[model samples]
Target: MKKTAYLCITALILSFTLKPSTVNAAASPVQETAKTSNHTAGIKQEQPGTLEEPAASEKPAPSEKPAASEEPAPSEEPAPSEEPAPSEEPAPSEEPAPSEEPAPSEEPAPSEEPTAEIPVQLLGANAAEKTVTLKWDNVNNAEEYVVFFLKNKTWIEISRTQETTGTFSLAGYGTKNSFKICSYNSEQRQTGESSEIKVLIPAKIKKLQTTAYSKTKVKLNWKAAKGADSYYIYGKQDGKKYKLIKTVKKTDARLNIKDKKNYRFKIVPLFKSTLGTIAGTASETSYKNTEFVSMGHQKYTYSEMCSDIQSLCKKYSEYVSYETIGYSEKGRKIYDVILGDKEADHTILVVSTLHAREYIATVVCMKQLEYYLLNYNKTVDGKKLSDIFSNCNVHYIMMANPDGVIISQTNKARWKGNANGVNLNRNFPYAFKRDGSPKDGSYSGKKAASESETQAIVSLTKKLNKTQTLAVVSYHAMGQIVFGDYGGKNQKLRSDITNMYKIARNTTGYSSAANYGGTSNGNYREYLTYKMKVPSVTIEVGSVSCPVPKYQYASAFNRNKLLILREAAWLENNF
Candidate 1:
């Protein structure tokens, strides 16, 4: 019985071990479970290693059948192992499952966007009153804004602020009032502008009346306009169109006219607050014959005038040196008129119209030259004029800025630039640099002595070695003024020149106004006085309306001629 028991135990153990291996190898869990249950029920197994399979024809006894029923315990143990494998597989696969879900969520988050940026818009502008207002939508990411105003078609930065609501107001934005706006971030990158807004400023007119007592004196007066800072009174005579009679800061109700004649009058009110902005209309008024002399004659064309001068120099070639000093950009010859009986050791240089609009000086100088040449033998104040001309050589450079003159003649309204857009008067070798555009009246050349017109003059002045240039006179227009060396403290020729200037002022009935403010730099006079140490004066001729009207030529001549003649006489007496 012990031997049978031992054999049965071994068979039972083998059966148990083999059952698990078979279950693990099966492809389908259901089939594997069915097979395991059937095998457990059939085998009368003791333990895994002791179990054995039954023979084909063998049959189990009733007692062995009961032992086979215990197979359920082995089946239960395999069930626990299978459950753990399923649970372990899920744990490993969980990582990939979370990754798949997050991708979809990311797409929707990106689709939802932030706010967009806003654009600028301009509202209105009034140039007559010198005011402008602008409006625009608020921009995203904009911390502050800037407004730009347009004057004479130029965009000028006006103001900047941090207000979100888009309303901007500005004053002192002059003629051709236009506006635009821009938004900026902290980095200062400009966001685009709104649509351009444009406006027109209407002109205002102020009228006045004046009468001349005699052929040499005139009194003028006018009522003040609301926005008028100053008044410009103009007179007209037969042959000549209009002449600026006077400029008055104070509003005098009436003025006395010294010259007797038929006079047509007009007025232009100027805005003092805005230097270059706001112009008033010409007043409509006509008066009968007055004491003023009428200037009526066909003025010589540039070519004709130059030819006449050349001819005159040729006739008097024995007593003078005539040379083509320079050529304009348009190839017009510039002549230098030198007169002396002997080689000039001490020279007095006289130049006029370094700026084109200053034609009055050019005319005056030309007349003086003619007067000296024609009446060389005449005596004035018990002195022989010929002897004076013979002793000291006088060099007259007429129309130094020919190109500028041509430009001014062609474009009366905007006639400030040379052919190459340089202000010849400002183009000198000494400190000839400043910030001004071609549009401004004082545009210096790209470099010192850059323009051919200016270079030619400089070269000629430099080449005149025998002559020790004593003094220079340059002429300009508008204000009745005389300005001289302000560059240094030493006033060498101040008293003498001032005395001469006073005499000139007395003769012409013009006032003495000095350019006390040293704002205009790189001027020819400044260079002559400061750098070359030569005494120079810039004589402003006529009134506010430059190239004083043809009708007012007589009054201008009457007032200014004696003064210039005295200047020439003084030059002869002193130097």
Candidate 2:
């Protein structure tokens, strides 16, 4: 019995040694659970917001299964330990994830696509209607357009439209209307913009001047306004509202009026565009039938001469003009009134007032100029005055010695020399002889051509002789005579002088005298006769004295007015 019991214990110990242990198999699961719990704790520390995913991952850990494949979302899910949390994503938070940093910013960043194109637009203004119109071509992908105007250099929205045209009131806007347009999408986001367009009102007219030719005719002229296509001239009678009388492209307009009615005028500059015509504002002025040149009843001063010259030139612009040949010693202009075509081949030079006291000559010459201008289109002696003088230009040196004339009229009634006390008649270059120092009367200058007056005359004569067939008529005072003989041997020249004297004799019934022999003191007629071979004569008018009285002017003008025409006619026919 003891031997059988020991054999059984050995058999039991051998069986225990042959079988696997149950404690290790049971402890394996517990060890794996502890490992998974530790891993889950580490994951929770890394990802604080993901508690559910960690617990779900821990439930499969005790089975010893791979938790990565058992996860509900493997490709869609983020491993928090390896990747950023949902808070770090750019979609949810301000801070962006590393890989998703450029996605949100780069996906919707096509704002520059709209700014690529700039549209060209048109702007029109109707100043009369007080409206401005903006028009432009349709832009691609543009749903609507916003019109904005500049206010203190900043653009402010004015209107919005789906079409390409818009209109706005221009009452508050000034002359310079600056505007721009912007295109927008359906969401009202700006896509593109147009260049600024300026709609400007035409500027008002200035320097309005009126000239009355006669009781029935008037002329209006003004300086050109900016952006003006034409000028609208309005006329009113006796305090009535202005009515549009004419639209003229030129800056000047003429009006034919009734004999005795007071009229007012205003000129509005008109700007034309494709939309409509607009008129600018203007100031008003009255009209009067006023004569420009005086009737010689008052003392005609230099100022009067300038005024008359300006008016006459403006009225008779077709046949009349003037230029300053030279200035006097007192800085007064020496006016030469031209009364014919400037391109004429022949010239008739009429000089007056060489002696200061001989002012009647200036008056007579001015009357003659006016007479010719008045009868310019009239038929006289088989031809119109304009036609007669078409080939011959009459140049009137109205007052050669303006300084001397001023002195004679203002200071001394008998002054003959210029302001320099030099006798201009004796200061010519042909037979100039310096007599002595300057005195009150008849004092030759220190040298030939010393005085500005003498130099002007000499220079003019020389210039005329170079290009034209020139004849000179010099008018002196208080002799009622004509100097016909220059003592030259040229037969044709003598004949021409004789002919000129005959014309003067028949016109005025004046006497003839041999004022210029071959040898003489310096004389203008002698200079023309000998040096230049030009036919010239000196006619002395007024029987009583120098500075012929105003009453004697009518007779002098009546006799001399026809003299100029006749002489011009003779030259045109003969020379």
Candidate 3:
């Protein structure tokens, strides 16, 4: 059986050589596959095959016997092929399968940075300290920040930082500096830059000014400094160290400092930075000094009178009540300084300085306030001063014609008229002479009560009439005399009028200006007397020389200081 098998294998091997044109079976029964290869020339080639099957074109005919794709063993080696075997189809590229470990993920080409759209905030600029700080809120994925300076209306990059805050030295920033900011992401991609923030460093003080509101108060004013947050009101009085009086937030702010004329002020602008409860301060460059005008002694200016009276009222606030009855033609306020019991049913209205030259009488009224306040609630004539004043509100108009008083005080003229140049005393509506030309020195204006001062008096008298006012006293300078309602007979006078004359005579030995006429012409006295029936009297103080100097204030005040008190005390019996 072994010999027969060997003979069959030999016969098969010979059959392949003999039938070269026809296909023959190979020793192995496995099917032959086409070898696929590609050349650089892009051409396909294959080994020789049977006529029935073209080289690598179509599938070989199916046969039970396996085919030998190679030629039967040649005795000699064939010409060597410079190219490798051509494959019927190119082998699939050796691509690595999807890695479970992800093959290190090629380091995911670092992601791009986020856009920077953060807004910036400028905390403050302290020029004195030569520093400027800028800040902003952190942007998501922001890796860094860039700062830009606005130059010539263009934003130029100035610096970069990783933090949200940045600062610049102010030495290079001139009077004004503008800046902006932008943020960048980890990928170096940045968002649009923030809006510009400007820093203003004020210029040094060039001028400082002051206005004397009164003898006791002064206001300091000046132009606004460039970037000042607040002004430091400093004062340097005679022989005193500089002191900060107040801090004004506004540039046009006003405040009362020292009252004395010798006091000078220096305003320094200041700015502050608030970080939690802690704060930092920087003072702006300032070296200007200013002073207020003195009006009381050096010049009896109207402003001084207003301020002085205000101070006096403040000092004796408990007993004094001041109000602006009306405004003069020149807009000067007509003040009525009321003294005694405000709730008093029996009241007295004392008016002074109706004539410009008689301004000293105003001082008398002021002294009366001081004296009365001191004597108030005290024992007088063995009776409590409070009892005397409890039902008597003494309305003392310190200066009836403030405009006229200022004119006389400044120009030294007998300016008895108000700012409109009409005689305030002759401008009253009661018995007023409308026929008198304003050109006349003592002309009663074009009509009765034509002057604001007179109108104020008229309004006050009318208001008091309802309040049970007992008497109205008008004080004048240039004549030390007492005059009362001139209507009808002197014997028909009320007992209170007679008593007032006697008191005036006994106190100052002044003569009485007896009147035969039933009414005076264009005067406040007549308006209060026959017209209103309030029992008015005119007490002429000092000489007829027009102006009574302030020097005589003591003498005049002393003579009449007790006159009002005496009359007020006798009201219960007389009225």
Order of candidate numbers by lDDT, starting with the best? 2, 3, 1
Q: For each candidate, what is the lDDT?
A: 0.57, 0.74, 0.62
* Residue runs of model 2 more than 4 Å from their true location after superposition: 1-145, 148-186, 189-215, 218-228, 236-243, 249-253, 258-266, 280-288, 295-298, 515-519
Q: Write the per-residue lDDT of candidate 3 for residues 461-574, one digit (tens) a residue.
A: 788888775687778875788885344444534555667667667766677787433335787776666677566677888864767665666677778777888778767556
At residue 535, give the lDDT of candidate 2.
Answer: 88
Q: How many residue pairs in model 2 have overlapping backbones?
A: 0
Clashes of each: 46, 0, 13
Candidate 2 has a TM-score of 0.64
User: How well is each residue in 1-575 modelled by candidate 2, as lDDT tens digits?
Assistant: 99878765655553343222322332355445654664544332223323333343344332232342333243224354336444244344333467566543332212334463445444655666767766777877889887777767666677888888887775332355667777888886667777666665677778787655556777788888877778888899886787999889999888998666778888888776443566677757776444455645635677777878886776666678898888888888888899898888888999998998888888888888887876677786576887878899999898899898888888888889988988888888878898854556768888888888888888888888888888999998877888877577899988998898898889878887655233356778788899889988788888888777888888888778788888888888897
Error of 3 at 448 (Å): 1.2
Question: Scored by Cα lDDT, where does model 1 land?
Answer: 0.57
Give the C-alpha miss distance for residue 394 in model 1, angstroms: 1.5
Worst 10 residues of 3 by lDDT: 286-295
Clashing pairs in 2: none
CA displacement after TM-score superposition, residue 230 of candidate 2 (Å) = 3.5
Name the weakest run of 10 consecutive residues (lDDT summed) in model 2: 17-26
